[model samples]
Target: MELYKAAMVLGGVGDALGYRNSRWERCPSGVAILSELKALGGLEGITVSADEWPVSDNTVMHIVTAETLVSDIWSLTDLYREMVKAYVEIVEQIHKRQPDPATIEGCSQLKPDNYLLGWHTPFNKKGSGFGAATKAMCVGMRYWQPEKLDNLVEVSIECGRMTHNHPTGFLGSLCTALFASYAVQRKPVVEWGREMLKVLNAAETYCRKTIRHMAEYQESWFYFETKWQSYLEERGIAQEGQNTPKFPKIYNAEERDQVYREWSSEGVGGRRGHDAPMIAYDALLSVDNNWTELCNHAMFHGGLGGATGSIAGCLYGLLFGMVDVPKGLYLNLEFREKLEELAAKLHKAANEGEAV
Candidate 1:
């Protein structure tokens, strides 16, 4: 079965691999053409384009997340501080590299233009503002520090609002961060997945379905949010029957599904778009007690969508122990072993009831 732990690594792999094939330009008709090549056969038969899917901030953001996980000593305060540090570093680079009088005209979040053209970028707007990482770390820290959960959740969003004002962007980031917090505390991912959906449903109830998370997968620029039918299939979450969306379960698909659907029916329609619970449910559904498959499936999903994919990956990491992860994937990673070792240390610390 796909454990939440393995999903962390697998999600990245899948996101990268899927992006490679589906890259932004590649479509159902054919792959994208980066550059025109001369036709060997008739001009009509010539191959004009190929495929190259490059992940955007979604992939890059995870670098920050992973860094936060490995290097911060698992301290919530340290994690939040470092997360902001990373975001600042990236934004500073963007600011430095930004074309003067940057005419970033669109409302596109996926661009340097957003940083250049957008008014009062987060770096300048908020005092001590971080991204969703703060919330995740903060809120997750809550389980261990229940009295502070509300404060952390609120403050985390305040920080996110410094840059991301949009409901989807802020809430999505917030939710993801909270989930991460849970993982850091070694919470069972399946339970975490269940809780995430519950939060969305509760938020949706009063919001009147005006908002929803559209966890999109991009193959390239311009073309956003690819269809995840096939990718879901490969990971085995494509088959939707049991109420997994509303009622996710690690051991029981039917119970998970039933609970998921029950909660979802009462949820906001718009808020259900990129239903993270779906990915969480998929992680639970894809499991076979193997634990490794969780990360594998999440990485597979990451091929479809990055943030959600990583969440799925992290969940797998949270649920099943990291030892179940494959030797090669961990060994071959860019400091893969380091991530594993850090996680192990954190896990030991958490189990030993030590707070960083």
Candidate 2:
């Protein structure tokens, strides 16, 4: 019954704040799309709801990760740190011209994998459910046992508990981190996308049963008949005790399936939301593609997965090497400055783990 304009807030703030430093060099087309998103937020339309504007799970999730990195203690409950980052986002642009930021926006100190700070699952709240990045914070904090860590799935499961307490949400996180960890690593080492496919397929294999529940995922015909229709039908079909459907060992055997697999709880590309790996996948594939468009799709399609979508979007956009994202949006995405500082801390933590 309520019309939500939070998406517009995210788009507007991202554009306005980012226009200065880290924002992507404006492309005529990208600027146009930015305006479109801005207009959608009630700037032009006679809005029915004003306070209803929510930056959504996308921005909040990013807030958490950005906050976590800057905290004195790497704890998820550190809300104070998060608030600090929210207030001081311009720091991301501090060293932009000096010594050339090793990564995006003078973000030389942070590591790629450690970017995600925390997560939040919907738990049937009818909103973005916790996805991958947040749970990793929760699980990773405990499993500091680097030696025993078997694979990405184990890490994801332990971390997923921070928010997405549900098995379905856990599955999404498992796939996202496993693949992001893999695809990101493969990029500079080997340009070929095939090398990273193993991790993606591996993740899909682990979430096979849940994947089967989605109308499009259970069979090829559903996907062929209608794209988004099947998306709606498969949502929330499984109850607490009904037993979720089984998943598949491979990609959906349908259109452009190989290029991008299912990414959401549906266990397919249509999974909606973000996957850091998917962004890298597309970036590696399309040079002419607009980073803003890719980020928009990842951010907008992601609420079902919540914070995972936001972190995943950042990971993917970041992987494009900073120059990829629109200058206006990246500069003002609520916590860009703290993100760099946080990235440094995360990088230090990661390196400390490696040294030990």
lDDT top scorer: 1
For this target, which candidate reaches the highest TM-score against the unseen true structure?
Answer: 1
**Model 2 misplacement above 4 A:** 1-35, 38-55, 62-152, 187-289, 300-312, 354-356
All-Cα superposition RMSD per candidate: 12.4, 15.3
In TM-score terms, candidate 2 sits at 0.43
Q: Which lDDT tens digits does candidate 2 get at residues 1-356?
A: 00001221232233232221222222223234345456755222312121222233334343353344335653433432342343234334323321111112112222223345322212321112333333233122222233423444544542332333333344445544443444234333122223323334444454453342234233332221132223223332123332232223331212223223444434433232233334333332332235444444332221221232333443343244444444434333444444454444544454363321
True-structure lDDT of candidate 2: 0.33
Residue 85 lDDT in candidate 2: 41
141 in model 1: Cα distance from truth in Å? 7.0
The regions of model 1 sitting more than 4 angstroms off are: 1-60, 63-84, 91-148, 155-163, 181-194, 197-273, 285-297, 301-303, 337-356
For model 1, what is the C-alpha lDDT against the true structure? 0.36
Cα shift from native, residue 223, model 1 (Å): 23
